[model samples]
Target: MVDELQDSVPLLVFLGVLSASYVDHVALRRHRRQILHLQVLEYYTRPGDLILFNGRAKVSALQRSLTRAEWDHVAIVVPSRDGGHLQLLEVTGDGVTLSPLTSRLLAYSTFHVRYFALRKLRTPLLSRAVVNDLLERFTAEVEGLSYGLSLRRLLHARQTEPALSRDSTFFCSELVAHAYKALGLISSSSEANDFWPGSFSPGDFVDAELGRHGASLSPEIIIDCKLLEVATATKRSPST
Candidate 1:
């Protein structure tokens, strides 16, 4: 019996070590996946790319409820010259403006943003120079434009109808549509209000919404960034 017990001791220790090794391997792989997912935005974004948001604010909730869409906001990516960071062209309540990607991400905790790339064929439509020129001209022309927000407009959007005419003010999705139009990606006859935030999302629903305006803007999503909490934790981590 003593000899049998001594033989079992080595087997038990080996089994325990083997189980621990497997657990550690699994944890390391999980950690790697989290890091890769977080770095996706840096790896995949390009000029004219898009970032769509599912927001948690009351206004955002209202927009999503009315549109029956998951995303309630969108921004166009503008790559920096130094290739060190990215900027976003968007229309806020403050009107048309440029904001840093990191700052925007840090500011909005209750939003999940996804990266979308323009179709390869459509990417050739606007050169970098043209994109810059159009943004500059558009920004200057609509410097102090108000964000299109009112009960009337909200009701109109619920109907999914385009505004009768383009106005001096612009809304979030409207601004993106205008940019697409100027880039020759969408029809010239299309008005800005023809687009709502949901129009950019991928689905038969978005296809029908944009089709109603006689234009199309489809971008493929590269990353959903659902691991936003992982990013937040990294931010909270002490610097090395």
Candidate 2:
């Protein structure tokens, strides 16, 4: 049975790639009208915002298939503290790192970005300074840890009760979830490893088959994940 399942793995992955391609097509078509220029996005976006990436690569397709969601990766916006430049705090293969937002978007021509804003939330409890301090401390603590992609741990996630990750390693969504939890935006009981890239998505997009434990945000904080196409060539106009 193990041999048979092993032999079928390739076929399953191939089918996943095909399915993800179709979904990408439909999603891009539906949100084509809502695309925004990269510069315009950078100017308006601030810290504590979330960014989702949808890539056309086979690995990305497999991720989409595994999670049964549109987003394959997630990142949090962070203050650059360098003349007000925009940067993203993300967990890549190189581990937890900061990268210029515009350059990262420009790196992948086939990948499109979706923005999630929290600026609309007006609550006295939502302190930007506190969140920023937490972000700084969190990033400083886990800056160069290895990206966690252990198949064993992933399989363990299938169990009735998924294990909480308190290790140094972090995948993209796990890192974001941890940050959210540290900022008091999510419940302390929320397991970072239980969150996939799709878990942070707006509305009912979370996949039940993945065994994700659904870490919801605080009721006071509203996430505006409007699918805006980030244009590579488009520049911000002179006037606001």
> Number of the top candidate by lDDT?
2
Model 2, runs deviating above 4 Å: 1-27, 30-33, 81-83, 110-124, 153-167, 204-240
Error of 2 at 74 (Å): 0.3
Question: Over the stretch 1-240, how does candidate 1's per-residue lDDT look in tens digits?
Answer: 542432242453454311112112321333211111323354334555566666656877787898787677877766554545777778887877777765665455434332322221124445556766665565455545667667777766443535423356777887777766655666665566757777776663445534554444444432323355565664456779
TM-scores, one per candidate: 0.61, 0.65
Q: Candidate 2 residues 1-240, lDDT tens each?
A: 542442242443454311112122344544421223344446445566676777666777777887787778878877765536777889888888888876665554334443322211111465657656777777676667678777665444542323434456788987887777666666666567778877765553222211233233321121222223432347878996
Which pairs of residues clash in candidate 2, taking residues 3 or more apart in a chain or in different chains? none
> Against the true structure, candidate 2 has what lDDT?
0.56
Query: What lDDT, from 0 to 1, does candidate 1 have?
Result: 0.55
Top candidate (TM-score): 2
Residue 210 Cα positional deviation in candidate 2, in Å, after optimal superposition: 21
